[model samples]
Target: MINFSLFVATVLIWGTTWIAIAWQIGPIGIVLSVFYRFALAFVVFIIGLAALGRLSLPSQWRFVVLQALCLFSFNFLCFYKATSLMPSGLVSVIFSLATIFNAINARLIFGERVQSRTVLAGIIGALGLVLLFWHDVTVSLDLDVVQGIGWAALGTMFFSLGNMMSRKNTAHGVTPVIANAWGMGIGALVLLGVASLSGADFILPNTQSYILALLYLSVIGSVVGFSTYLIMVARLGSDKAAYATVLFPIVALALSTIYEGYEWYGTSFAGLGLTILGNLVMFSRIKPA
Candidate 1:
């Protein structure tokens, strides 16, 4: 039940994070916003861990660092860049491919079994994504947008690697909270260094709304979302927990309908049906060995 709740929380929070990202567009640059989001979240996490006496470094420092880089730094950078160049909905559709990437990579790297049902579900979900965002995809594709899709794909790949790494660390008995806090800290430092190198301005938004958005993103989106997700992965296993990705875009699309005033087209509804069906097939608890 706790695992189920974690999965639901992860999907709901991350689904709405796209809206939050949209709010971050004006005033702050993307890189700077990414840096601030993670850095602030890291600080808050560290303080919380200290208060709870739960903070500890991983035994395999190098692997932890690599996980941080892949999960936090590179993945986010690519995702942000992808959104910058393309529509959020389109970017999200591409991001849905993470399940496919994860399945393949897990099979190759971790000797995880690749079930036929999982593969079929992944394909159905991909098709659903396409249908859901068909309108957005039908729009003229600029060079930048094309490049953005590529980056988004790369980000998904990095994310899959991070998932595998997290599973590995969990097998070694490291608590997800401890691993996440340290990984986020390292990722924050790396992003900060990049910001410094790029001479990115780090001005705080004076508006109450902007400040509130930043706080929500840092605390709720980054820290809470990430920690809960890692915990879910630890409890549910990577494949099961990763179903959140399938559910997230659906939430995002729902939010879009309300906030962005997006109309629900027929294709969109069909896509939603297919996506849910695919997830059901993939996570049906049937072993595919």
Candidate 2:
């Protein structure tokens, strides 16, 4: 039940982040914006944990630093770039590939076995994603589209590596919440350094929308979403935790219908059906590795 709750919460929160991320794309450098988001998340999350008497440090700094880099910083840099070049929802489709990445990375990094069921689920989910975004898939395949897909794929790989790091941190007695809080702090510093070295301007955003997006990204998306997600990674294993991302499109469909005026097609409904089937396969008694 706890895992279920975390899955739902992570999906719902991240589902809405697409719009917030879109709102964040103007004027500010992607690195600077990511820095601000994590900086704020770090301050708020650390203070809350401290006030609750729950803040704690890990046994070592190396894995936490790696988590900060892969999960919080470089991943978002690639994702934000992808969103700048294409629809944010399309990025979710690519992000769904994280399931496969996590499985492969686990096998390579931890000497874990790769289950056939995991591979089947990923194949089904990938087909679904291709159907769901078929319009974009069948488009001209221009440079921007290629770049967007590449960045999103690269980001997903980084995120999968981060999941492995999170699992390693958990093995070292670091709870997900503590790992997330510290990761956000270190991630913010990393982003700030990159932004500074790139000569990105530090101008404040004047729009109300940008402020609201920043708040949503910092509080709900970074703090609550990542905390729950990493907990799932710890408890369910990174393969299962990564599979939760396949549900993101369902939430995206609902939100996009209301806001983005996304029209549903026959293929999209079919895609959603396949996606749900993939989820069922993943969570069923299939003896996952």
Candidate 3:
């Protein structure tokens, strides 16, 4: 039940983050925005963990640093940029491919053989995403569209790689809570360096919406969302933890329908059903004959 809650919470938090991210896009530099996000999230972690008396650094820092780069900094940098270059739906579809990326990287790095069911579920999920976003997705071979695909795809891979690192750290007895707290700090530092090098301003946005979005992104989205997600990565394999990537966009579209007046076509319902079926297939415990 707790694990299930973590999955659902991660999906709900990250799913709605799309709007907060949208509010953040124009006010601050992408690098700085991501920097601010981790920076703030790190502070929240410090306060919460300190209150709970669990604020020590991990004994091993190297792998955690790699996790920070992939999960916290670089992937977010790519994802932030991709929104400008491509349809957000396309980006979501690309992100849904993380199950496959994680599966491949898991086999390569951890020697875990890919299960046939997982492969089938991943394919189903990917197809579902294509249909779910069919209205907004385009096949334009234009430069921006191509670039967006590249950025989103790369970001998803980075995220999958981060999952591998988290699995490794978990095996080494570093809990996700500790690993991610340190990771957000390191990621913030990395982003700060990049932003400073790029000559971006350090000033906070004056807009109320941006400030609200930043707080939500930092405190809720980053802190709560990553905590739940990495906790799942530690408790479950990253392969299963990553299944959230395939589901969250459905929540995003549902929110869009409610708040943004987004219309859902017949294909959208079919896609949603297919996505749920894929989830069932991915998590089913029936042994293969």
Candidate 4:
């Protein structure tokens, strides 16, 4: 039941985050918006942890810092930049590949056994994504689109690394909430430093809607979402937990259809079906030899 809840939470929250990110794009640059969003989330999370008397610093601060930089700072920056270049639906489809990446990385780093089902699922999922977005890919000749695909792929790789690092920390008995709070704090500082050096504006928006959106992202998306996801990873293993990314894109596509009037061709549905089937295959536990 905990696993089911975590899966639902991750899919629902992350699926909606793409839309929230889209909302943030008009007035501020992507870097600045990402910086502010994370910074605010960090502050809020720390304060809440402190108030609850649950905050504890990591023993291996340097490792934690590296994880933060990779997971929170660079990963998010790449995601936003990718969205800037490609359609949100396409970016979500690209992110669905994270499950495959996590499986391979887990096998290599943690000596976890890889199932043939996982490889097969990953291949099917990739084919689904290609089929679903072939029209969008064909219509664009812009260099930005190519660059976006590259950035999204890199972002997914970073996310896989972060997952492995989190699993390592979990093995050492570090709580997910504590690790995430510190990680977010470190990531926020790094992003803020970059914004400062680049002379990016740090001014807060006056609009109530923008303020509300920021708050929602900080509290629900970052703090709750990260904590729940890490906990899930610790309990269920990285390969299984990463199934959330594969499934969440379908939620994003659904939301896009409702809110953004996103048009779905036959290929999009085919892609969605294939992606889900692949994830089911990838996450299925095989019998022991």
Candidate 5:
């Protein structure tokens, strides 16, 4: 029952974040926006953990650093840029492939066995994404669209890698809240450094949309989203928890349709159906070998 609740919250919160991210896209640099989001989230996490007496640092700084790099910093850098170059929904769809990436990464890093069903699902989902983006890839000469797809793919892969680090921390008895508290703090610092080196503006945007979106992204999206999702990962395993990606994009696409005026055709709908079906296959119960 708890797992179910976490799953639902993860889907809803992250699903809406893509559009909120779109609101963040105007004058501010992507790195700075990401820094603001994580920086705010880091402060919230620190206060909450300190108040709860759970703010102790983890033993393995290396794992924490790995998690920071994969989850908090680089992935958002890629995702924010991706959203700028492509529709938020499309970025969500590409990011949904993290399930497969997680499975593969788990097999490699943790020696977790990958089921045949997972392989099959990957094939189906890959085909679906290809079909969904076929028109854009074939017809558009815009470099940004192509780069957006590449960024989304890289972000998803990094996200999967971060899940492995989370699993590692959990195995070493590090709680998700602690790992996230440190990870977000470290990640925020890293972003700040990058922004400084790159000469990006450190000033906040003067608009309400940017402020609200940053709040939403930090509090709900980063703090709540990462904490709940990583806890879910610890309990349910990364492969299972990542199924949220498959469903959340549906929510993102709906919002995109309404706000971004995303036009869809029969092919796109069919591709969505295939991707959902692929998720079903991937999650189907399998007997022990």
Candidate 6:
């Protein structure tokens, strides 16, 4: 039941965050917006943990630094940059490959065996993603689209690295909440330094929509979503937990259709069906042990 809840929460929160990111595109600097989101999240976690008397730092800072860099900071920097350069759905489709990346990384990093079912499910999900983004992929090669794919792929790989770090932290007996609190703090500081060095504007957005988006990204997306997802990673293993990415693009595309007027065709429905079926296959417990 806890795993189920985490899966649902992570999917719903992350899926909608794509739209919030879209809202965040104008005026404010991308790095600044990323900094603000994590800074706010860090503040919230610190206050919450202190209030609960659970504010101790990790015993080892190495994994925490890794977690901060990959998960809280760089991955999001890539993702927000990817979002600016590509359609949210296309970026999401590329991000969904984290499932495959996680499988490979888990095998290499932790000596975990990659199951055949997981590989098969990844193939199906990749096919579904291809169909879902068939229009974009088949279009005449634009430089921006190509660059967007590159950024998204990089971001997904960084995200997968963060997942491995999270799993390692958990194995070393760190709770997700405390780990995230420290990670967010370190990440926010890193972004602040980057923004300062780059001379990026630190000005907040003037619009209500952007402010609300930042708050939502900080509180719900970073705090709730990351904690739940890391919990799932600890519980289900990174290979299975990372399948949540497969579903994120589906929901993100659905939201895009409504907000961005993305036209859905027959192939879109077929892709959605295949993606869900792929998720089931990934999660199916009836396979041979």
What overall lDDT, based on C-alpha atoms, would model 1 receive against the true structure?
Answer: 0.78
lDDT of 3 by residue, 216-259 (tens): 99999988998999999888887788778767877766665665
Better of 4 and 6 by lDDT: 6
Query: Model 6: runs farther than 4 Å from truth?
Result: 140-142, 286-289
- Candidate 2 residue 207 Cα shift, in angstroms, is 0.8
- Report the CA-based lDDT of candidate 3 relative to the real structure: 0.82
Indicate which candidate wins on TM-score.
5
lDDT by residue for model 4 over 21-59, one digit each (tens)?
666666777777777888888899889988999877887
All-Cα superposition RMSD per candidate = 2.3, 2.1, 2.6, 1.9, 1.4, 2.0
lDDT for model 4, on a 0 to 1 scale? Answer: 0.80
Best by lDDT: 5
lDDT of 5 at 48: 88
**Model 6 Cα lDDT, one tens digit per residue, 182-211:** 999999999999999999867887799999
Per-prediction TM-score to the true structure, in the order listed? 0.89, 0.91, 0.88, 0.93, 0.96, 0.92
5 or 6, which is superior by TM-score? 5
The residue-by-residue lDDT of candidate 1 on 119-172, one tens digit each, is: 788889778866765655575445776677688889889988888888878877
TM-score of 1: 0.89
Question: What lDDT would candidate 6 get against the real structure?
Answer: 0.84
TM-score of 5: 0.96
Sorted by lDDT (best first), the order is 5, 2, 6, 3, 4, 1
Least well predicted 10-residue stretch by lDDT in candidate 1: 133-142
